[model samples]
Target: MSDLPPNHHADLRHSGPSGYISGLTMIVGRGNDARLVADLADLQPGDHVLDIGCGPGTAVRNAARAGIRVTGIDPSEPMLREARLLTRLRRPAGEVEWAQAGVEDLPLPDASVRVCWSLASVHHWPDLEAGLTEVRRVMTAGGVFLALERRSPVGATGTASHGWTADQAAAFAHMLTEHGFVSTDVSNHDMGRRKVVVVTGRT
Candidate 1:
């Protein structure tokens, strides 16, 4: 549906009971992506990680298990509620907190996070530049930044167009650099039955 650029699904939002249920069920398949990003963070005990656009807190819980503190921020209260319920059912080794907010505005202090990541969620950001600025502001100098998105074909349409194409991924990497991130890279990987593209950088 869209090409070359990022955040094609900027207008997409998850709210209400139905949206929360869908996030917990349909989008819950992002477990593989969660693990991929958690491993990418390469965090140590007591490090602070920030998860943007966290849904159902899958990646949040996964990373927190590494004995680090994590803040999972989302725009939907209902989704945060679901995340809290699931987290309570199965606790992680590290501390975990949740906030209801969008990428454009994070509820965090400056240079407070060691690693910041978003899994299969960056494309939904309403304002990619503002989101990246917020991410950079929250991350410490030399902090890792990563984003994972399913690989969508260049001309794909409908649901098949939800993810990033190679060019789009590269574009996002460029944006990261523009936002003062260093060593930005764009790479491809596989996640379960899906192919994914990952953009990485350091703030």
Candidate 2:
């Protein structure tokens, strides 16, 4: 875990109209991206998956459709509320639980998760290293971790502040390797209208 200060917690919260905009983005704009993460996770039936920085639970709902149980964790109460509402409306096949938490502080037991997915959310993490450590701690041996973030010049959002460059993606992949993750791969993917940097690692 990183020894850095924790001031980013305030930046993590999504409230007011921005929260609703984020929710709408997850629901309508990022469904394919969520499915890509779910596919990359290679979930097994009854597997317990964790969605860190899960905004509005879009990825949670997507993964649950494959019959894997999911827990969606985020620091934003408004996001969690939207997630719960969406879950009720979608009624995915697998069970989903929502938690008000953050990547630096996962509210789960060690080695409890079979897979972890974080989509378009890593930039908001308070401390990337600490968050990855927490993710590793919560995941079982050989568990998969898939994270996707928009690249700069994002065609859809045009939000560069939360986006990464190719070099940054490579650096993040190296960090994963240093943290004891094996078979780490980082690459850019064309997700229809937008480009994304995808990082996959295993514990």
- Cα TM-score per model: 0.95, 0.88
- lDDT measured at residue 162 in model 1 versus the true structure, 0 to 100: 86
Evaluated against the true structure, the overall lDDT of model 2 is 0.79
Clashes by residue pair, model 2:
none
Runs of candidate 2 exceeding 4 Å displacement: 1-12, 153-158
RMSD in angstroms, all models?
A: 1.6, 4.2
- Ten-residue region with minimum lDDT total, candidate 1: 19-28
Residues 1-203 of candidate 1: C-alpha lDDT, one tens digit per residue: 34547898888888887677767673457778888877777877778989998888998888877778999998988888889988999899999999999999999999999899988789889998899989999999879999999899889889888899888898899999899997898888876688998899987
Model 1 vs. true fold: TM: 0.95
lDDT of 2 by residue, 100-198 (tens): 988889999999998998888876777888888898889899899987987764232335446666665666788888887877988788878878889
